[model samples]
Target: MLRFIKFAKDALLAFPLTLIFLPFSRFFSFLYYYNKLVIWIWKNKGDVTYHDFYSPFRDYKKRYALYENILQEQKLKEESICYLEFGVASGASFKWWLEHNTNIDSHFYGFDTFEGLPEKWGSFDKGAMSYKIPEIDDSRAKFFKGLFQETLNPFIQSHEVNITSSARRIFHMDADLYSATIFSLSQLFPYLKKGDLIMFDEFSVAMHEFKAFDEFVSNFYIKLRPIAAVNNFYQICFIVE
Candidate 1:
């Protein structure tokens, strides 16, 4: 009985020690995995990568949040114009928007390379073009192919300047690279109105996206305030007046 008591006491004392070291152990494991992931990314930096435009396996919570935002926005207005998305992975978001956007006149305008991202995008890294885009069509949905700036400029200039311009926009930027994001932002800057929303897929990434957002804001002298930020730190939805 005494031996059992001593053993229990010793075990109880060691519990705190285990608790103290567990966090460090987990952190070290995270560091190891992070370093490995970086090495893998570096090794396959320019290699052809897959782009689904909309992967069904995306984080469900993120998708749900997107739907809730759209639904809430629709309830506030009858004819809320269009929901624009830059990287139409497999048209997942487009489908979500179409289903939830019961507002009769609302549309979804998705722009993509259709051939995946460019071979060499600016300086930081390259995007993958391994996945093929699937076919989707809706009367209200307009799909454009090619580089974002190349395709968007003419479309915006043509549709946005009319006296009866119903050309409002809510853009989602998910290109995940500095050059693509900046280029898209520059082209889209002119069309943005007071309540227009911009959701950046790669916002606040330590070195890649935060740098791009900062540079664009500074260079353009724009004030884009965050409206909603996801807990995962993967995306931020903003509005610019």
Candidate 2:
């Protein structure tokens, strides 16, 4: 029986699976993560999460409500937070934080291409959702006008001491593509600390943000406990526990 089991495992490993499955891998990967997402939500959506499970129509505006609640609950409005936003497309959320925080010591860093996505995302073509960098008068706000791959490291190197300071850290992951999301998270992993906040803007999209997030959590073995989920987990917030 042991010999047969070993033979079966060897046969499976030896099989030229990629030749047959590579074409449909995209679809299968999506299905697999979709199911994993559902399961994750069901298991983790405990009494703690500010959840709305049966949202009929997703209102992107609800993210503002989510922002409000998280800020209020965390008492972060007046705190000096290192606000790192990966996707600052129109700067709506960025401005929202700037308006609410009221902390002069708090620094806001926005990273983006300011042109559009580097690659195609879902139905949106490459370079879709393009916007000029928003102009702001605040000296506290700094914009990195390029891909995260190009900018984050240099920023980190320059601001290492300030970022790793006792100031609160809030990382807002609005980059919609899995590749971008995963890249940002993995790069940011080493700097993550307990009680730091992380958020996902397009979290319910299983094949993209969710897939990246799932893998990131699993890979890092990081302790991230979900605090709030709005729009049926489309926009979810977690704290590094």
Candidate 2 lDDT over residue span 19-89, tens digit each: 68878888888899999999998888885458788789888899999999999999999999889999999
On the 0 to 100 scale, the lDDT of residue 112 in model 1 is 82
How many backbone overlaps does candidate 1 show? 8
Pick by lDDT: which candidate is best?
A: 2
Which prediction has the highest TM-score against the true structure? Answer: 2
lDDT for 220 (candidate 2): 94
lDDT of 1 at 56: 39
What candidate 2 gets wrong by more than 4 Å, as runs, is 1-18
Model 1 weakest lDDT span, ten residues long:
45-54
- Residue 152 in candidate 2 has what lDDT? 91
Give the CA lDDT, 0 to 100, for residue 167 in model 1: 42
Candidate 1 runs further than 4 Å off: 1-60, 73-78, 119-133, 161-168
The C-alpha local distance difference test score for the whole of candidate 2 amounts to 0.92
